[model samples]
Target: MAKCTAVIDIGSNSMRMAVFQKTSRFSFHILHEVKSSVRLSEHAYKNDGYLQSATMNRTAQAIGEFLSIARSFGARKLLCVATSALRDAPNAQEFISRIQREHNLSIKVIDGEKEAYLGAIACANLLPKMDALTVDVGGGSSEFAVLRNGKVETLYSLNIGTVRIKELFFDRNDLAGAVAYIDNALSALPDFGIDTFIGIGGTFRALTRALMKKENYPLKKLHAYTTDDVRFQTFAEQILQAGPKKLKSLYIKTDRFDTIKPGTLILQRILKYTCAQKLVCSGVGVREGVFLNDLLRNSAASFPANYNPSVRYLLDTYATHSDHGIQCSHLVKRLFDLLQAPLNLKADYRHDLVIAAKLLPIGIGIRYYAYQRHSHNIAMSGLDYALSHTQIVLISHLLLFKKGSRSSSLIPRAGYGTLLPDNATVDALSAILWLSHILLAARINADTLSVHYIDGKLEIRGKHLYLAKEQLRNIVLPKNLIVVFQE
Candidate 1:
């Protein structure tokens, strides 16, 4: 595989390109992303599913520019796929041939089933595992993939879409006709008794973003944001009934006004059909799936056991003193084992704690001074894949608090209290980390330090005790916990 690979998705409504750079065999990060509103199916749906000349020209130009950007980033492999627009069009070969001749780019026109599979695999590998139906509502068609226990079970695509419905029924101002058309298409799908829905593509993302803002969500990350079905259904109903002025007030962008209603209706009806109880918004789609499919072709399209792409990427690119980081991680784990019972920390938290400790010194690669802030910001933004928003926020906060800090004050004061465990839990975790930092501050070998907890007091015995003992005074211990250092 190329060190840097580019994946392009030419949809009915948008043309997007993402460039991913590999850090290790199975670790990678997105380097650049570009999106253009080409709207390739603009007049095609109304004109008997024939590719229009004007939209084709615009799409060609965008693809050409995307290729230039990809080449600028030294991308050696390019995988470009076209979805409903090209597959439904009668004259798609004309646009494909033109792109091939002019820009030397080959566009693979994928069927609806393959398209749904791509989107499903992306969510399966990138987001937290779940058993649900993945809904991808595009401009020309809507695709569904059934995922069970981190595996894709089935896939289906419907002829109903935002642009298709808009041209066929909504343009005629026939609301009942639109609903009937959607229901007719949906009737072919069998119920799977799945109560959760994973929404993909731009329409779902836009709606979820608006919901996030209206509810004053603290976390800015959108990938794993979750909401109950009742709230989402109400919001979708309001969108269907909202006028142009009302949509603007609801935070719907002006660019999406024309097709938002159709997309919302498609999504709302599907949610009803599936009897969805929860909605998990997906920020990844076919493009990411394409990359992952190629990146993990040998590994059965799944990451190695116990491996996280985002964490590996962080360690690969940012970790300066990896030996120390590894040592620190071991020390923290040992400390966690000794204090887990007394501190009452959950066993599941150990994974996150180890990762945070291993990457704590990554900020030093950027600069030596005030590196903790850098580490905090990097963790908040870069730990995006395969983890929930709460875990991400908690790990970032754990990296932020060092010696002489109280987790209760720092977390709530920094607006992340809602995303963390209770104050006592956080303080215990923070205290363990702080104590580890103090023990290793003198760059002593981790083997030189030993820790044990008995009753309510914690004892540490190590060589070069002066620095550890001195820094211990400036730090705050967990409530009712005592630390005694010995040489």
Candidate 2:
């Protein structure tokens, strides 16, 4: 496998490229991404499904530039797939040959089922394990993948899409005809009894992004952001009723003005048919799915058990002393175990504490001063895979604790207060984490210290603990607790 692989998905409405560089086995991060709204199916739906010369030329030029950009990042492999437009076009072979002759880029035209499967693979592996129906609305087709227990069960694709519906029925002002077409197409799906809808592609993302802004969402992440079916259904209806001016007021971008209604309608119909209870927006689509399909070909198309890609990428790229991070991670858990029974702390918090300790030094890789702030930002932005928004925000908040700071002041100032646990819980967790750092400030082996909580005081017994004792002066112990250090 190449160290860097570039995956391209040429959709009917846009052509997108994502370049991924592997940090280690089964771990990688995106290096570059480029999207061009070529609208390759602009007139194809109405003109006997023949791709227009103008759009084809525009798409070819964009692909040429995408190739150059991928090479600039030293991408050693390129995987390009075409969906909807090319698969339906009568002159698709001509366009494919042109790109092959001019830029030496081969495009694999995938069928609707394969396209749905690709998107499902991305959601199955990258998202937290769930039983949901994955929906991907493209320009000329809408795809569906049934997921069961974190695996893809089946895939279905419909010819009803934004551009397809717009040209066939919406343009003629025949709303009844459009609804009939969508309903008839949806009748092909069997009842899966799934309530969750995992949305993939641009249409879902654009609508969700607008909602996030309207609600003043604290976090900037979109991948795992969730919304109930009723809230999204109302928003989708608003988009359907709104004209061009109203869409702009709703934060719909100018590029999406033409097809936004069609896409929204398609999702609304599917959600109603499937009896969806919730919708989770996925930032990754066919491009990411294609990349992982090849990358994890031998590993049952899934990451190793309990291995998080974001964690590995952070450690591989940012951690300067990974061994020390590992040592501290173990020490924090030991401390948490000793205090859990004493302080009445929930055992669930140990997960965040362990992860926080392991990633503590990630900020040092950016700068020695205030590296914790850097770690906080990195976790918020980079920890987008497989974790919920709450977990992501809590992990970042853990990095905000200083030697002596109140969680009450820190929680409000940091924001995202609604997504976090209570201040008392956070204060306790922060105190444990900070105390662990103090104990290992000298980078000593974790085995050197032996700690146990007895009655009201936590006993710390170790040799050569002079530096730890000195660092303890600035620390604040949790309420109803005291620290006793002895050599």
Clashing pairs in 1: none
Q: How accurate is candidate 1 locally (lDDT)?
A: 0.88
Prediction RMSDs, each to the true structure: 1.8, 1.8
**What is the Cα-based lDDT of residue 328 in candidate 2?**
83
lDDT of 2 by residue, 234-297 (tens): 9888899998899998889999998898889899999989999989999988998999999999
Model 2 TM-score, all chains together: 0.95
Off by over 4 Å in 2: 412-414
- CA error at residue 367 for candidate 2, angstroms: 1.4
**What's the lDDT for residue 315 in model 2?**
91
Q: Against the true structure, what is each candidate's TM-score?
A: 0.95, 0.95
Which ten-residue region of model 1 has the weakest summed lDDT? 407-416
Return the lDDT, model 1, position 108.
96
Query: Could you give candidate 1's per-residue lDDT for residues 1-487 as a string of tens digits?
Result: 9999999999999889999999999999999999999999998888999989899988998888999999999999999999999998999998999999999999999999999999999999999888989999999999999999788889999888888888888889999999999998999999879888999999999999999888888999889898999999999998999999999888899999989999999998898888999899999999999999999899888887768899889888889565666777889999899888888889988888888888788888788788887888898989988888888988888877645678666765647678899988888887777678778888787888888887777888878878878898767777778998866
